[model samples]
Target: MSNQLVAEMGVVFIEDSEHHFFNARLAVNGKPFTSLLTPRRIRDFLERNNIVYRCHKGKKQVNEEKQMEINRAVARHLGCLKRPFQDGSPDPEHQYNMDESHFVIDLDDGNPLDFVGAQSVKYRSIVSDRSSGHNNVRAAKGGSNARILCPMLIFKNKKSSYPILNLPDTVYGVYYRSSPSAFINGRLMTEWLQEPRCWGHAWPFTAARTLWMENASGHCESEVEDTARELRTTVRLFPANATEKVQPADRFPIQRIKEHWRRLAERRNIEAIRKGDWKTGSASSGKLANPGKQLFLNLASECIKLENEEKDHNSVDWAKKSMIQ
Candidate 1:
């Protein structure tokens, strides 16, 4: 009966009666039963089942109509939908998906290892100076041609006194502290979109391009829209909470870049240990060396190169089914 009640709770019809039935079954078995279910016990059960709770405050709510509109807009932009406004959708080469992701200098949480009866373990690392580092990456692929734009890296530093000397000339570095959040703001977005390096090399002669991005405040600014209009690029905003499902960048490219970065960082740490650059000490005293800005640039560049090479191998598949294509 307890099992039956638990199974019923997993279904869609859980209500007061279900709870009462569960309690009655417990009472029949001469076990303690209560009128109200304990939240703590419920959470414990969920945790045992590998389910975690997250607070979804201030999340954008998209109605069915809005979602449908978003779908139609995306289809039209991809040349899959017949619409007068989208008569000549830009080819894949000219269509780009852009997004920003934040990475920390240190691991956010420690990894699990083979251990027995241990309360905790400690790993030493340099005190992270910058907790918020932003990378704005753009991925564009059309048929057999795929181009990964040189990413824009934003460090948490004053714009005037940013340490430009620490970075390589190949990677674009911006020193702007984002307010209230780790992501970039409207002014910075405009500045980045206006940069010649972003669009000049990819489509030098083609004025008409399409940019798909999430509906974040930074991406939806009036200035950003005006700049896109001036540059002859149409900006399309994805529906709220829909980027992970629709945006190609979010689907694979961004994740690949971060994975590559993690691997590179691990290798760098190993090399540092081998070279005695990293100091060894007790858990409370040890300090691990942090990769500098130049290393970050190198990792980002290598990831881009790797993705570009992989894209070449899969270009035929992409050409046939890619929405951007």
Candidate 2:
């Protein structure tokens, strides 16, 4: 019966697969196969069939029509699809994009260093009852120019239980803020725009600047728009459900940052274990300290270092070409 069910499922997956398998109305022999599908069993079946699940292929949201509409709207807003860039090209230095991404200190990407042909490998990290810290990162990049604005980092307010001692005002082109929700809102948006660490440095480049952002409630607030206009900045909101295609930050840098952050966190965990800082038998159950502002600062610093290195290499190559000319 199970074999028959699996065959039916395979057919369903091939013929009329939903983006999410769980959303599909799966059945066996004309009856709903409501048994919980365990990962182990799924893996077993796939191994038997010599089917390999490609981890690199990411799943997208099932909103094709909505995404298409969003793409059209973004093109219209950017004055690109119907118009030529030469007619009204925005200054590279004045064009910026910002977005937020979250990070969980205890969550690893599940990449295990297991021996070949092992059934499974498991690693553990300190689990907490409270939610993982939120990292509201904003990646601001300009057009043709290679300049990148400092990324912003926001975390939940430090409580006595999760103490962060002697936090610095700024760390290596990244600004840190502690908020109740660790999310960007209209008020926080206004403050970030006005802050010297962010748009303040770009003031000399252009009198009027444009910022591209998603249609989040915080970015869409009327007050936020009013504030940007007052600051001689124009905030362009990306069309609903279209950020994946249109937002430059979402395209690359944000993912890189998250990847680097996870690596740094893993290294930190390993080091803690080596130093005996994490007591496996302790009452706390050997969970490492709640990753605080400083850890994020280090992650941001590493990202900046890598970006600068790449930019410098590109600059050198350009300079060599100029000399040849």
Candidate 3:
């Protein structure tokens, strides 16, 4: 059949689907319809039947023109931010941005892995009786400078307070707290903003200093603004609906750093399992223990040390690109 005819047929199928046709069995066959029981099933069914469609990689997407507008606005915002440094202090020691990278438990699924070059894959594999039905997580948020501040670690607990982190004198201290869901909330946001190192040290672009952050609900709390004001800092909200484009901490730094985190976590997780060290099991639970906290601080300190020594990559514009791209 010609491609045009197939495309027209595909439109007809879509119209039928809108009317709940996919949910009904075929009139011609009282026997089971081979597949496609819901609107969402249409894509996979069409693919199996040798049909094609253009698909964007992520579920969430914006119109091309809209994204272009967002990019241009971000470029302009970045240009204005650079003006403060242009007067020749050179290093933007006063400007900074921060964001959170949350890691979740993907520990065990019933799925089995096969040897890379094996001729025949075996079916028998270990499956636990206590299989998990839901995933849990904890998040870490950190600020950036030539030296990254100690990551503010959130631990999971239903308590009002957590054990004080006895930070090693060599690196910046880590702030930790507990929450039921382990996600950062208004309380944590307020606490983080209150930290002197967060904004107190940075020189302002205007009469009032503002810290740029994405429009997260927690970050927009009245208390957060109040706390920032108390610290003599202003809270700068990122453009609504523009994520990585306007979020200084969400894009490039995360992309590269997350890759490093994965490599380090994966190797340690596997080695720990072999030696019966259960601390490597969960990203937050076992890993946020005293030893685990030490692990994170040390690893981060090492990376920061290297960043400090690498003069070639430390140009003012490059630093801006690295943190906020």
Candidate 4:
């Protein structure tokens, strides 16, 4: 008999196709669900059982996936910046990598224990936390909390303290802040370019002779192009989709930097909740409370040394192996 006929008759049978006899005891109604034994029979069983399955899509998941696409596009744009100079221009004596980053400061509205359980937000499972339920707003006051502050860091090749130039006549090489206004420009750019005291002697880029920069609107304007001409230096733009491979900031060390920033932010949040240190405005302000700035300098000066030393040791080992072969 066909398997379909056997199932319709509600009788259990075991038989080899080549064998004549079939034998098995069948239960008529004692089963909650049927189990299929054959590996190839899943579709048949599922169709017979009328089962339904569900999939979930979360907001954060969607946002992160979308952001990854955007990152790829941005990386491509940065890669294009590294192309050889088109005009066959001579290489410039100096070059710099420029970028901006954002930081945050938590504001207190008298809510210290504002955390809701993670799983509770999604209907996965319930985790009732008594501490998270407590209204501890009055407990977190006097915190040195305020608006966010952000500062741009410039990494240049070769050791020098050149001031950032301000070019009002032409729009190239203007530095921008998160705010609406330009932070640095014009004579500031010229002076900084000429001055060898500000950003000179920085590692990695400090040793570089040719500078590479992205084509930010402010940097690529005709005036800034003119400025580069006067300086007798060549500017090379990276190819699109290649920043992740070339830019030092996009390289391995950045993850370490972000991890450190997260640690600092968590510590500050704990401190603010425990003591009303800044509510009265007596706590440190401006440059002092800037966690991002502090972390960047510390990593640049000290932690980077450790990383470089390790890289050097690895390089030496690789060279020795190549010689042995």
Candidate 5:
């Protein structure tokens, strides 16, 4: 009989295709059924059996079947990259990741005081305003060997300046620019590609290196690829819809940076409170003001260090997930 017919007949003949569900694992020693049933058949079987899908921990909210296929693609891609050196293994130092992270300034991410079981809570900031969320600082980070390649900070303005008196940092200083949205663009990406500090850190000019980046519209533009070719660099894009699982930088650094930035924001808030900066005049008046652009710039420099990197992964097989933690 067709699998669809068998499932609809309620014969209990189908095992979960996801193969990760608790109930499915408890059934038949957690072994997947020999027959590969279509997702429609599996869904029908579950619905008929009164089984409902439960969100699993650490799993994204994508269609389970689609996620499974994505995982397979991730494994194949990583597996191909993991072959021995004689068979073209990637040089850890030359294998780099490039990505952009948008940061909001003068924003308090702290949870406001609320009573237990309250359905909702709201609090007003003494200095922060609604407009703070729209203004972003885009940090373009290049990393390899768990080290940052001196990040470039893009601010949301046609023109702006930093308050730091120092000309350059002794270690891992910053490169700054301006964009209307404080986000990356094709021109900005091309500019980054041509920066000597970026390529110089990896090798002599035109020395071959592997760059892993997302297939975003901006990065895939002809100009960006053309610039990379001039530098003797090869760009490999992350598999579609699988960056969360396969991107080392996305898989790790962003969370660490966000946490550190939060701490900095909190400390700044406390200082402001102590100095009565929140009090505009006779009393704390007006919206709470955000920290200046400098805070965001400092954040980019601190984020690319080895200590800030992901250090505690269980080293799950790369082919099954990612090559790095």
Candidate 6:
């Protein structure tokens, strides 16, 4: 099979099967044959010329230094919190860990085109599930179903050395606008601050206590810091560029929630398809509803609920049961 070369100008040229190189023209016009070259030169040039490869798909590590400052604050707060809970303790209350998570939602409404890999290993098109019967076949609308966001915090009982997880009310939070300002609102910041307060929740407490949090963009706010100072609560910050290795949420549970959430979304999509197929002419009295739209709404609702629950729990609960078991 011949390889196709999309030139810098996006003029595609199909090479002959016998030729390994797909002829690339340096310029779009003016003596095309003179500018013809092999793909090897282009590949070699791009490799040697490129600099500054970024991880996480070109995402810039902005505010990293400031983030470290927040981590330090969190660490200091935790130290204060743990003092009373220590064996020969000083304070017996107010300590916890808080962090956020990210997830990817994969839906089945629109099947992607197939692609062939090296050694002729071909990927197949995903077919819609049919277990629910003919009433479910619906057109795919390109969109996500849901996201399961969690702000997890852990609490401790100094007496028993027992720990409980404080989870928020909803599994995910929504951004009304794409701008950062919209997502980090007053309500969210308040919740983030209250996570270590041990406020209005019944749970065992260690004789000594401490509050801990990573330097997330949402939590590292001036307002929260001022509030912490006024409340007499200590905020401890982790070391710079060390969240991936230290934060419990980053280390555990967040990944599991995403996997579970994706499975749930896929299953819900299938179930919705089974319930709604109004186009099929069957019983005049029994027309199906729009499953695709309903699926999105349902998934969105679930995500919102999970996020709220997790947030609420972070502020209130002392511990949570492990989802793994």
Considering every candidate listed, which one attains the maximal TM-score? 2
The total of clashing pairs for model 1 equals: 0
Give candidate 5's error at residue 92 in angstroms.
2.0
The lDDT-based order of candidates, best leading, equals: 2, 1, 5, 3, 6, 4
Q: How accurate is candidate 4 locally (lDDT)?
A: 0.33
Supply candidate 5's per-residue lDDT for 3: 33
Model 6 Cα lDDT, one tens digit per residue, 184-269: 33334554445432232322332233445655565567777766665555566555456665554443345444444555555543
TM-score preference between candidates 3 and 5, better one: 5
Where does the lowest 10-residue lDDT sum fall in candidate 4?
Answer: 134-143
Candidate 4 regions with alpha-carbon error over 4 angstroms: 1-99, 104-192, 198-208, 240-242, 245-248, 268-274, 278-325
List model 2 lDDT by residue over 1-325, tens digit each. 1232334444444335455554457666775544434445656766776654222236666687876877778677666522533665656556667777765555433332234455653444543214556666564655444434576666776442222458866576777765677777776777677777765555533578777778888778888888788878888777777666666666456655566666566566545544456534554554666555677677777865554344233453221122111
TM-score of each: 0.62, 0.65, 0.52, 0.36, 0.62, 0.38
By summed lDDT, which 10 consecutive residues of candidate 6 come out lowest?
134-143
lDDT of each: 0.56, 0.58, 0.48, 0.33, 0.55, 0.37
Error of 4 at 48 (Å): 37
lDDT of 3 at 181: 58
lDDT of 3 by residue, 120-169 (tens): 53332121111111111111222244334445655555563556346343
User: Which number leads on lDDT?
Assistant: 2
- Tens digit per residue, CA lDDT, model 1, 1-325: 1222223333323323356564344542454444334445654565566544222248677899988887776665445433533666446556666777777755423232223344445544432334435454454544445556656666555552344554535554222323334467787677667766655564433558777777788788889888878778788777665665566666566767776766666666545544556534444245455556667666766776666555435453322233442
* Model 1 error, position 86 (Å): 11
Give me candidate 3's TM-score against the actual structure: 0.52
| Candidate 5 residue pairs in clash (backbone atoms < 3 Å) | 106-290, 126-287, 126-288, 127-287, 127-288, 127-289, 128-288, 279-284
